[model samples]
Target chain A: MNALSTTVGPPAMSRRGPVSTGPNIPSLVGSEPQQRGMGIARSRLVFVVILFCAAFFVMAARTVELSLKKAEPMQVTKQHVTVPPVQFTRADILDRNGEVLATNLGTSSLYAYPARIRDPEEAARKLVSVLPNLSEGHLIQKLSASKGYIRLQQRLSPRQKWAVNALGIPAFEFAPDEERIYPHGRLAVHALGAVNYKNEGISGAERYFERRLSDAASTNQALRLSIDSRVQYALADELESAMRVFQAIGAAGVVMDVNTGEVIAMVSLPDFDPNTTRGVSGNQRFNRVTQGVYELGSVFKTFTLAAALDDGVVDFSDGYDASLPMKVGGYTIRDDHPKGRYLTVPEIYAYSSNIGTARMALDLGTEQQQRYLSDFGLLRAPDIELVEVGAPLFPARWRKTSTVTISYGHGISVSPLALVTGIASMVNGGRLLPATLIRNSEGWRQGKRVIAPDTSRKIRQLMRMVVTKGTGGRADAVGYRVGGKTGTAEKASNGGYDRKALISSFVGVYPMDDPQYVVFALLDEPKGTKATYGFSSGGWVAAPVVKNVILRTAPLLGVAPKTEDEGLYKNVALRIEE
Target chain B: MRKIVTISAAIAAIMSGVMVLLLNIAVQEQASLNRTLAKQIHDDREAIRILSAEWNYLTTPRTLEDRSGQFLALMPLRAKQIVNTPATIPLRPRGQDVDTKGASSVVLSSADKPRKVKKNQRKGTAL
Candidate 1:
């Protein structure tokens, strides 16, 4: 054992001596390697933890941005974008009874981002197929443009938009747009007017009420109109029927509430559809009631007789010699059917005697006549919603000759609107209310005084007399108590009155005792037909139209039929000498 | 010393548990807010759509005519119906109240002007 120990100790001592050449070298080296490995592993674990935290924070920020911001998509290309400085327009236009007259609708307009389109031909083909209305040449021209973006079409229907979208053409896109639609085809086209592609009102009541319709301040309120759809349709129907029956060049009619001054209905024939007014002719587009001025022949006699009675120039007992033809200004004014005897004032109106009317006007004198006519709203343009209003044509200088010719409705011209409104005031208790296309509210009664109540009553009596015993007899509705005046003026040709061209018209008021409504019908250049034995008199052509309209609309308006004992006609009936 | 260590460990565990609960609640609240905002945006879009549709419906010519006929009792207007109130007519009475009568009676008596029968005019002629 000693010998073995001595041998191992010597080797261990030699090894220790070599290792101790440096201080604790073997032990230090072993501990240093382990420490280095542990440090690396710890640093790696820390890095992993930091990465997880960073990932969590990133996810939280992404979620917040998506949920909280609701940001609009950023535009990727340079394009013209008009950012509205304020919120869009107000509520829609509705009729008096809450029917929609005008409204805004969402539509899609097709645009092309040329930079994004991969296949121009394919996109063009797809778009053309869906929008067949576009010409192939136009489509090709549009697609071939070198511009970054181009508007392909405006106001595409939803179906068309969807069809275009389904093609998956990357460059083809839809832009949001607004469009206006007039649902009722051609019924009230002239009254309602039309809008452009941008939903802006261009004409009619729509244009007149455009500001109210588009005002953001009026967002919740709808613009109401005084027009009644029912009455408008009835008038249109009657006028169209009249046109067809008479084969007249054109026709027009109006129905107005006498008491309220509300325009119940206004119909103009040969009217264009507001829905598509692209190809409407100027003649068809003319609003005859408000824009076309005509020499409304005998209808003017109502005003003439009313003036005479109100001015104390004539009374029921006043008589005029209707036997002679009055020649004034180289024009012989004679009644179509001369009585060949003295006619009472009431009889003159009843028979629409031109000679008597001229005599009455001569007695009133030109200044008085012009003043009365101006007071009746005849010397100016008709008050209406449209910008297109016709002014009454009167002689620049008033003279005795002019007065005589104008007395029998031969020298002046005025729009049908002016005539109706004037007659409305005469029969509606003498309050000259401005014609309004918008619906009346509680505050709409503001109007000017045109005449005395007594004068109105007298005029009403005369009007009733004409209906019951004169030329307006055909205009009488059995229980409606219709009173009116008929005008059959020869249309002016090249500086002369055309014998063949006649403007036949009838203006009537119902229940003359308390006139509630005034209706007027006019036929332009109406030809003489077999129905009238080749005669186009106002009574033969225009009066019956008013009668039919009154009869048909009376029940609809809730105006009950009157009994014979109602005593409504007592004051206006002519006194027959026993 | 051991008791102190055990108490410290328990406190740390409780704190961690509370933090986890708070985090869970925050996540739930964020989800609810997201849903509410989404719903509001959807509703606004829908309102815009409805208003647009109504505008189109109102402006159509056919709809306007129908409404006019149904509500206003209006007839087709003519040029003759419009008059210059001051021009051709005489001064009417002012401040006179209208009397109420049946519609039919009003129609009959309103047209007081007697129509001149043309020498060859026929009776009961349709307009």
Candidate 2:
């Protein structure tokens, strides 16, 4: 209505002419003939209209093309159609620091459909080149057996897989299967335990937590153990070296958090790899820390003295006449570290005097001794996570002689774990915390108070004196104030204790003013070595290992190395030894 | 003229039906594509698990000890080599690598532990 409807002449000029007459007139006048002008204007109008129509057509076509586009056939690939759902049959076992200890790993096993396989001899010949372990004739015999399918190899290296694939045999195929694997093989074998070929947990933590680990719902999450692999490695490394150096039959060590009772590391040397556990000797698999029960020698004196002090039957200043061997019920009691004089309580403990300790036990009496030892968790098997825990053997009768002998860690047997757990109690403010393998085990809060705090302090002092003034001097790792006892026990043989073979052990607590960790190392029948001055005693063979373990694991546990009098952990100033 | 109008309407109806069918096909294709991507993600996760195992195997203590070549003298860190606290590290004397007065040596023994600041230590670091 405004312009297009009102104008029949060229719309462009008319639209412009109505608005600006001056400019339009000059252009109209200076232009060519009116007829030529009309013709050109009409042609231009048709061309512009056609151009608009063409552009509209193009847009319309594009709209249709986009809206009704044919879909490419669904590119459903064979792999997409056949992807297997990921299911971890078992939960991963991880160290406290979240390092992978044991997990299931899928390995490829090459197999051949014998019926479809053409030229079996050729295939075997080619396969043998890549896998030299499989003899060509044996492989051919198996391949040509007319069986449904025969295994060429159970485990194929990546290179072997590629090499076999390069040969392009259609009949040969790989079947994927998973096997339980321990990346740190043999490093934590005793603690982690073994698994069967069917992926069933057989021993150790594996057997201990089989249900939780194998359940589908819980398998997605990993089981974090109280164990620190670094600590485990160090303890194993040191313990193995000690065993080798001492020419020992076996060795065991445990490093535990004194307050939490979380076993940081448990090592038993002459260990086997959990990965390939076929033909492993039963003796090699025996977990000495948790399963093997030994008398554990004078390490028990700490318990006896702790018990006596706890019961208020003995004081630190009290003295015992250790100059003479005490005869109790036809049993003669003597001291390996014989100080033939009146020995104070500290002297009796530091010197590991069987006579003095026996006198203390006799003062407490048999009933009192048994009660304390039972309370200290020495009279029963350690309720640790492993299924292979040892049932402690002590005198069922609890005779007066038994009390005297058990006072110095004889006439009874306990696992290394039990001894360490008991020591953890004696040092950790008298709370007998439950030993645990699971990370962040909250069972310590429910710890039973086995002794008075004052008594625990006194026990720690005695233990400290053992290292500072007595047999455990070799266990003192400088800057970290170690306090411990050395126990060199005679292995029991026939009707009596063997005079030759011995179990030498040292159990240490660090930063004695405030004990945080307990390190225990024991060598079973470690023979005399030149380096140890031919003394196969705990002070000589096992104490150095305790020192090595402490030195290596202190920083890892964030226990700042301090001088004996450095910070809150001041020197354990015992009363002057008279 | 009536025939032309009817024919144009018929063409329009057929095109609309075809577009709807094509759109439906497109939706199906996209859904399948989504399934494919999901499958790919699952496969990637499995691959990651395998690769992580391999990585852990390679970085095991025994492996690292063996792989520690001549150029790298890999020895277990001793406790004495560790510095206890930052305060004992002795304020680099506000100077460059050049010799500076009142500057303490970099090496501090365990005995020099001025454990004044003990923060961010492993109280079961990041449960």
Best by TM-score: 2
Task: Using lDDT, give the best candidate's number.
Answer: 2
Runs off by more than 4 Å, candidate 2:
A1-85, A117-129, A135-142, A145-153, A163-168, A441-444, A566-578, B1-29, B65-70, B73-81, B94-127
Model 1, span A403-516: residue lDDT tens: 887877878999999989999989877788878777777634646777777888878877877777777788988777788988899998899989988999999998766688
Models 1 onward score TM values of 0.73, 0.79
User: Candidate 1, residue A159: CA error in Å?
Assistant: 1.2
RMSD of 1: 16.1
Off by over 4 Å in 1: A1-91, A443-446, A564-568, A575-578, B1-127
Scored against the native two-chain complex, candidate 1 gets a DockQ of 0.07
Q: lDDT of all the models against the reference?
A: 0.76, 0.84
lDDT of 2 by residue, A1-578 (tens): 13443354444546555544554654654466855865776788889879988997998999899789986777658435444556778989999988899988777789888888778899899888878888999988877867687777776766778888998888889988777888888988988998997889989999999999999898879999999988898899899999988889999999999888899999998999998999999998999999999999899999999888988887866879999988999988888877688988888888889999988998998888888888989888887888999999987787888888889999999999999999999999999987889887553454799999988888887788888888899998988889999999999999788878999999999989889899999999999977777899999999999999899888888888865653321233343253
TM-score of 1: 0.73
